[model samples]
Target: MKRILILFVLAGSMLSACNKFLETKPEDFVTPDNYYNTEADLDRALNGVYNRLVDNFGRMYSRGLFSFLSISDEFFYKNITITNLKVMDFDAGQLDVGKLWEVAYQGIDRANILLENVDKPKMDETRRKAIKGEALFLRAYFYFVLVDNFGGVPLKLKSTNNPLEKYLPRASVADVYASIVNDMKGADTLVSDISSYNYNERVTKTAVEAVLARVYLTMAGEPLKDVARYNDALIYADKVINSGKHNLNPDYSRIFINHSENKYDLQECIWEIGMYGNQLGNTQLAGAVGIENGVECTDDKIGYSTGPLKITARMFNLYAATDLRRDWAIAPYKYVTNTTTGVTTKTPYTAVQIYDRTVGKWRREYETVTPKNRNYNSTNFPVIRYSDVLLMKAEAETQVSGAPTAAAYDAVNKVRRRGYGKPINTPDATVDAPAGLDKADFLTYLQDERARELAFEGLRKHDLIRWGLYLSKMQSLAVDISTNAPSGFRYGANAAKNITARNLVFPIPNTEITVNHLVTQNPNW
Candidate 1:
């Protein structure tokens, strides 16, 4: 399934590159009346929707979203945009903010177009339904991204037929979430079973359920504080776990490395956004997160990579030496070139230096096929993994019980055990297992474990925001970094003062406000 999807994307790209036939038609020239005629047309249109997953409007290969994760304590980047985010020194005019908004709406419009024309083709009922389900899921996912970042945004459920239909007022946050839930519920029945598919690249029943769990979990947290939703969160997460369709991959590193090879663990990855080829067509995750200006050795089959993304010293120190994920998740050294000998050697970095360490999760050296350009490697981004489901289940259980239940401990311990390379079924007190705790302590533990298990996967900021700890935590982290960081590495001076309640959600883009009078800026923007 993933290969087929990649081929479709590549074929579409080839067509556009070879000729101008696939290029955009003049406005007022192309219309739904002329476009929606066959199954092949629908497939081509649907591909446009999926293309947003890797589009460079906000930096391709999930870099736009991952940029938010970089602002959290776990990671850092030297780019001016990233620096602005780290210090909370950004507003409505931020380019990426506007780009993300534009790209998401573009995807939503594409999805709406597909939904409007899905039934025009005389195709198999199951196939048609699956296509419609995918469109709904994609739209909901795009809106979810928007709502999480920009608070309330204009909702466009149907395709726009004319210029008059383009302008839309912002929908209430509650209304937007309601639509998201409705779409996911509809998709749950329309999408096919995971086992029926060869890969988890596309939507499935379990994928819908997993995303519902995430949605419900988010609803149960900040800005809403609807604690009752925690039950729904637990119910949905448990459904995914008990479905027996997925489980945690024992080798955590393999989960990521497999992405570079175009291989997937359907048993672990619920849904992965597929990326293929090299250069502009490939994923930028490795180049954005891997070692900066490092070298490779032909004899050792090592490949080189360079990027601005780096791990924070605070994040690196969070891992216990016994945890296997530490070495696999954070690189402690970079390869240095011997100018005279033309040889490269590994050099350990100073522990407390900011931006001195690199991320290890997307290692370009482990790519199964060497990349034509080291800066662009085809590494699929994992959208949701089974391990996350377990942790979320644990979180919901604790929140619902107001204390850690036996099941809650089991869920969290499973991930912790895997981190230490211990057997999932056994409790290894010395190396893997931490002692059980009460509700408050367990929730705190779950937060840290999430950072440990899922750091740099683009969930950190959302997790902090939902926990209502975003401001306080960022403020505290600033003090710690400023106090402990080596003089030259101290970069958290503005963190304490700049981050505030108004930053809970980003300002609506100034471009959006300028073009659409119905759109209002977020508070304090």
Candidate 2:
């Protein structure tokens, strides 16, 4: 039996079993009066919110749809052709959009439910406040994703039973963004410090700042692209960078290792999802499901442990010879085992690992098995890091000042130097660059570095869109990786065939548009 914990509630489980705890019925089937009674209850509620991200449905809405659909061109890993990648079979027909739309609203619903009732009489004021802040941040996060992807989703800030209220037309993007801003601002104030909380599962003050910086940065980039918003983004990012609470981890390799729970590098990790091994943080899909590279395992196993996703030759070539980050990308290993037949069986597993850019950031094996089905050895995934904050600052500042400033260089170099194992330089000694780093040379450098640094944490797909270089890069890689594979390679053919333009915006899931007329399909899908 699964152990009941507060984190489970964050996973979106219904609380029907706890009917005995309610004091007053918010409805015939539910009541907030009986809930929100203890610190543990709040903790569980927050955990339940986090749990919503467990499966593909939950993850696709937050990452996969954006990463795979908007980012790269590679498609058909093995024999399966992903519609978003090929830009075909879209419309209301796509499952990716459906999952994304449904799960995001689900997350918002969970947040609303908690906010409405997590402050009952028996709840501790401090704990209740923290839970409220976390819920607010999560709701804002959900809305941020929704507005950015769908433009104007209906705003449902409250949990309501009225069927008419559920069918409201799409709200203006401005209204959605305003609500997101308000929620984030409240979160920043309510949870002023979360360094003490340390648990990755909980949101901290830095997390709120991180989200605010992103909000401002997105506003600075799109529709408005206002110079002032760029400055605002820089201000928020700098606060998180200099807060003295977080820093870049000295060892680049350690950032994604098994023991890296709750660890923040000194650079600028504003906020990240905290995960642990076991039920709380373990990921079977990330670990043992797919086959990457050409190492074939006969089992139908997808090889998430060490398969499915492999490092493209283009990415490998992008790393400079002296950069320590290259070391973090790929490690050569021979999987050797002694069998009962008195023979030693050894298979070479030489490829890039995957947390960020390494093929599998979490690579551990409970027992040696075929490539098709393998068990993961490690237990954590760093969803956000300080390096991204620097890149975001670099981009924002460049736009604000028109050329990369010395401040921008300092930020970029801080990450570059750390990647190359050099001592960090203080701001005073750094050289100046421009606003938005508009010059091709300067902006190009920042873009490449962002790729090298934040490779697989689910940013590649989105970054490609913002950069407007998605198709070119994917086309280049499909050709390059194919050339590098063993002559007449049979396995990666599908990956080469899956590139197209319709992939830019995943289609609105058919299920959603059928139910909510407010959800419009993305263009060209």
Candidate 3:
């Protein structure tokens, strides 16, 4: 019997059964033979795969993965445990590393199980293909995360039924990426269009293409250095753009606000991890990034106190004053209440440094349906948005041509125009389009633009790593903070010296190496 814990809840009843026989007895357990026999069974099995995102202890998009990546230059956390990660002083024994590894494999195993038994369901052929596509895309996504973070990880394509079968070796980075590409390509054909899907929460055709573009862009960057893949990246990104299925959300703030209300825009969001409800299905995303109450911004009702990930002054300075994202992304000041005089006054960050510079996006006050509580927030985490596709197009186009092409300029300017609250095709040289730039300068601009647009979406560390600037950027940021930053800034002590080339890829969990003899740690713990 497979030991994989498969939870299938359908029609308010757990799928549990036992059998007894006098002669020639059969196994009295729920197996693939008994459980995966109908369309409803397959649907529930797929739901189990989606449930991994909501699993508080092991979800990839949860605080564990996000906090681990927060060690990058973009964020500062005061907690000693998290500060170590920010400074690149962590090792394989880190709990978040092990938990993310375990959970990613678990999700992969579930996806594999679903794909293996997909044919068992005698449902509509199109629906079965769609479910299989979702499972395949999910499996590829899990492997992509593992491969990107831990270098090459054990590629478990099939559900493990025996303990001995679990001892698999890590595949080469090239092989892992090939699998991801194949799965994504297959998914593009099998999955339904985004417009036809019920919600942006589920896998769709454009989601597959968007992720494929990202995968290709990563291939074109460090480690792999497959520069030729830039063409493919541009191809897929342009497909997402020309498909007319998605568009940039005109109002930048509304994008997050709508997500808080569980009202997603299929036109903008390609895919998001569905975080609904105030208790069971809620996430700590808002709380992790939100500002604490009783600060200069007390009027803002994001009453979350545990702001683990604080925005750094370095990140704050990246945004231009005219850019609407600057005010929306970072809080400029906080409110302090006077107990003696019974008065409240605003204190700008310039006057007094706020220890926790909270993230302005994903405010709890925007959540109309859920009860206001720090522990319970239903803000959906964005996985892929149309703006990301445009940015990817811009980056790939610049790399392929060795300069910014007209399409590249247009692609980037669309996102910039939205940020400045200008019309999409605004031709203003000063406000919208900054001209007279070479290839190198344009690439730099693209990198900064990505950070400004996609800050704190759990992509910063990986972005830096792929750009081959993770170690250098960390060291540089450490020096900047040590020399000029406020006294409250943490991680400056260890940041400059701790980060090394080996720190580019995180150490494989030591527990994984101990359990699987075939597993090897990334170079230098």
Candidate 4:
């Protein structure tokens, strides 16, 4: 996936690397009819669609979320007084909101263009099917983003240059999810298996199933409340497990360490966004992953990060003393590096002072790329991991069977064992979930388990929303901060305090409402 992107990036070293993405288009020079006839051209177009996940500031892995979902229970943006998206203080006109909206549509349009032209390429039938599947998967993914963030958006399926097709009305939420399920289910049969690619960056069969599991699980909760979909979610999750394509990476921290080092862990990470060198040199595939969500540091050699993201006390308290993930996911120490000699030194944080610590999951110290940029690094973001699949199975299975089934307990226990640095397949009485918990108690256990295992990974807020706990959780967190947080840091509570019912779905960007006559603002916006 990154191969095609890197080729175009190196084509013109003197030019701005950001502008090279436009080369993916046949619009400037080669026409679609002539361009879509070749395999190389198809690859370029596919890369264009994938690049949507890499566009620095607007991409999912960027600082755009220091205040959104990622900033919920697990962490908070340190500059809390600011009245922007980070603190839930902005409106539809906010610049970041508009940029993200534009970027998602850009991805959708690129996918649509490629899908429409895919049949013209006289390539191998299998390869053509794979390419089409990838496009379909990506388009559905972008729509998922829109539906998750903006409620329902105009579903743009084809490459339409006509204004009539462009200015469509919003689709209903159920219709959007129906389309997402259909597109991804079709893609599941067409894409290659995980074994087909050396990197997890490309779309694979397991990735499709993994995301389908998430979709069905989301559909079973919150606004949708289609509880019957729990069975469908369970089926998709089991499909991935039964496929024998993935397993929990033995070391919990190794998963993210691999991400920072540009390595793939196919056994655990089913799909990750591939990121390469800093925008400097021959590489242009980096984003703000480590730079925006890691421990704060000023040394470029050690990997500079203005990562103002700090771990919340609520999240830190979830981990037990023996859990290896506690120290890795949330920084247990602060950097005291000697800047002149670049001799790195980190002082361990005392247990009582863990509240001030930062997100350590994507530490820049492990990043292998040299001459790191102040704002960018080559840390790949996980789209779906095996642990997530296991957890989803545990939740969905519980919902479908009206209790924690034997398989459900096993699924969660594997993740717990791995977190405790024990053999993942072996039983661990000390750390595994206690047996015989009822449905309500099991879900309560899962809420804490998910926070401990998957925090600061951009999934917390959505999980809260789906569980119908977003408002209540934030309100409680505000109370927690008001009573316990330091005076300077009390401002961090604004994000939780500012949250309201209208915050459920971000307002459709004013930029879109201004141009798209058929589209209207979200309720209360």
Candidate 5:
């Protein structure tokens, strides 16, 4: 007999009596008629959806991440596929996109299935709506990622009983956005009004709002360029900030540390991926330091694993020498002494952190697994933070008017003030960015501030792309991505000039073009 997955329990449970007690009974593992008949079943089903986040690094990392990271300035290798890497040329026809396209749809499919079958008798009202909201938000979030990256993707709003419908044609971007906004709007009403969910694992109303703000801001930026959207973005962001549920943490360095995992700091973080690692004697390290210093015993090296995301020299120079974030950015070459050999070996590796210039922001304490290896560290990734909301509000305000407004400055200053390690200051020295900054200039300042405040958090590419500064940034990155002097391949100062705008949006992966007939290849693919 073939083994059936637990998700099929709902199908089995449906054939039995519609009694409330019958909903709690379990039949064979495959059919829903046996299971998924109760409140707990829905909860577990929602858990499965949350569980899918763990696999995102595998699927989304390939396509969405590559596209997001390809701000052209990020990673900068010729061989890296995605955005504008000089080290790697990606063919829009590449098949890797299929995995991303499939995984997101699968998640959406699961959401639809839950939505359709979850409304059984005896389900608790609050729990039911919460589950529905989460599923809806997740479906919306996944579609948002897909549509943003691929232009328009197949809109599979309902659960498909037929496998044949999987090949549906692409929907228009407008249609996709409409669905995303609607789903999120509904979700916002249903989700609980909490800022942090047991350390930010579960998404809340603010999470919906955060993404809504992002959606509006993105619309204001690209193919839409609707200046009117900025007002909507500002409103949503303002709502989240004024909710007064979050605040920045006192220590900026500790925010990403494992010991501080799930601790809600400044009202800044609206949503983040909550993670806990195995504490069973074995250790794990943060990706930044582990991948670079070769101190990690996990076989992940910063130089190798972090080649593309390294910090740029220009970024390093932007920080004030006294800033704590700067300390987190660059770790000094550390030497571990071997107790047995009485030998002190220096880990002499100095690889770029966020930019070649700045130090790595994410760090974890390394436990020595071997003479040269480290064992464990636990750190979580922040998906949406309050600081981003403020900045978005600032940008929106500037765009709505002509120059940075006092409100915009205050919002920007709040973030900068916290980073300054002082009482939150508005119009203070650190918060006192040039007052006369025009809309165009203020926009540049916002981009740089985002780089400073949110670097390595994965928002870099999105900001660069929206600003229309990706090509120029990528050229600077191209020179850096090329073989450095010590590595033999060299590009002079002028060599960076060779990079072009054609490289901005990544070629639709060659594999995707080969397989998906509906996708129109992006320009220069």
Candidate 6:
């Protein structure tokens, strides 16, 4: 399916995607001043903007935010040899610290460039508007990623080709968030509805709304305790929920399977980084999602995985025995490949072995692509899902009302029922959280529920930070791991032990600090 869309991105030039119909020829020698002269040129430029969101190859998402840089209470990127980024042990000068910053700003810069040149093309007015909306939304999305990870960053609005463009000081966190909210809101008005598309990758109005809900919810929580944004989050979430175009995929494992197989579950996965090829193709566009986070496998034929990132008992114990998502979401067996036969084998683990399981939510065994690379797979990484929107809606409504309302419970219970492998519309009191919990208890429910339903989707650390539980939770995890972990796995506790208040926000890259004299390094970095 991915092969059908041969997208090629070379710096700021050459790229394409199949509407399942046509392809654009790669272009060159056309400088920015004269490039945006045709409709195809606009399309190519837009794809380049999209190309910046690779979410793999140590760039962002799975490799950066989700795995190495972001510290999680659910799992730790276990490596005794290189503990830098994984354990929150690195500083401003770390190569990955710069890479993460570069990747995010690259996307932002590309989006800015596309927007500036968008109007230059002589194209269909409606198509032009849609492209403009997507550029605006992606730009905001990039900024949101920046603000979420690094707090206030140097907010550069205009595109610059000049290497000597004056380095600006960091923007206030509040101002950066304001800009994100405004841009996304504007994009919501101009973008096409998801219902209009046969494909899953394009920036849709609901995607904007969903991200807006996330931004608002984040604003309402720790660091920025703007409680008023809870109402805004609820409103945007309602817009997406009321759209009637999205829902939880009945099978949770199948949702990820769809990503692995290059199939789109638009009903559940609201937005994703639609990657293609196994990095062996001419385009070389691929992601290291399943390979980095999947169940450990020794044989390449069985889907090779160097799974340094691992889940633990904390995640395994979150689910009840009846919750079908538990075993499927966490690999419950040991993987072995007989060298002579070259056949992979699975042996069921005893109960205690759950503590050492690799991340199973993105098993590479399901990847349909042939001749798969051991390091990179063309698996699409989800950015937002309908289930996440539902959770945000439930959380927002509860925050605004100062208690868990019936609507809040219903939103979450729907997800819970699905997790229990029951009909979502049917209410099972045995499975549902009771309706009368206080705000504190309900938030506690949310914390656990989110992990159960959405673990390894690259959100846990941010969720912990927003809830103001990051420092205390990691510190607690350190103590727990130290006391309870199996002897072989106890070293995993070191990552949590390395946590400090400063780890809540990643350091601004040393490259930026040195190049931009006006900017200051983050605290204790």
The candidate that wins on TM-score is 6
TM-score of candidate 3 relative to the true fold: 0.88
Best of the two (4, 5) by lDDT: 4
Model 1 C-alpha lDDT per residue in residues 49-95, reported as the tens digit of each score? 77676664334344656654236777655433334755678777888
Cα lDDT, all candidates: 0.72, 0.56, 0.72, 0.81, 0.58, 0.81
* Tens digit of per-residue lDDT, candidate 6, span 1-525: 142253544354444443223444454556678777887777767776776676445567545656776668778765562446776677788888788788788778878888888888677898898889999998998898888888989899998788788889999899999999888988998999988886668889899999999999999997899999999999999999999989889988899888887788889989887766676755555777787787888777768896667786777888898998898778776578888897779867787786678777877888888797888877888889999999999999999999999999999999999998889988899899877899999989998999998888778989999999988988888888889888778877888888898988888898988889998878998
Worst 10-residue lDDT window, candidate 1: 12-21
lDDT, residue 451, model 2: 76
Model 5, 1-525: lDDT tens digits are 000012223331221111111222333444444546788677756654544443323344312343322333433332234333333334554444555565666678767877886787477798788888988998898887777667776788887676455456668777898899899999989987773344455778887898899998987876657768899898898888788776666567666553223244435566654332322322111222233322211222222122223344555656677666655644444444567775555454455432232234543333222222232222345678877888888988888877898999888888787777866753577545678887888888888888788765556767776666666676655565454432422332222454455554445565555666776666665
For candidate 3, write residues 450-520 as lDDT tens digits. 99998777788888888998878888877887777666565443554577788778789988999888888
Off by over 4 Å in 5: 1-29, 32-35, 61-71, 74-88, 93-96, 258-266, 276-309, 330-359, 366-378, 479-516
Each candidate: RMSD: 4.4, 6.4, 6.4, 3.3, 7.0, 2.1
Worst 10 residues of 3 by lDDT: 16-25
lDDT per residue (tens digit) for residues 1-525 in model 2: 011122132222342111111222212232455565667666555655554543333243223542344334322243334444422334666566667777778778878878877766475577677778888988998888777766667899887544566576778767898899899989887774756653443567877887688788777554444447778888888888778777676667666542223243323444544322222232221221112222232323322332334455566666776677765544333243344554433354444332123243433332123332333211224455777787788878787778878778878888877777767564322222233445567878888888788765556766675456666776676676566555433244344445466554556666767887866666665
Candidate 3's displacement at residue 409, Å, is 0.4
TM-score per model over all chains:
0.89, 0.77, 0.88, 0.94, 0.79, 0.95
TM-score of 1: 0.89
Candidate number that wins on lDDT, 3 or 6: 6
Please report how far candidate 1 places residue 88 from its true position, in Å: 3.3
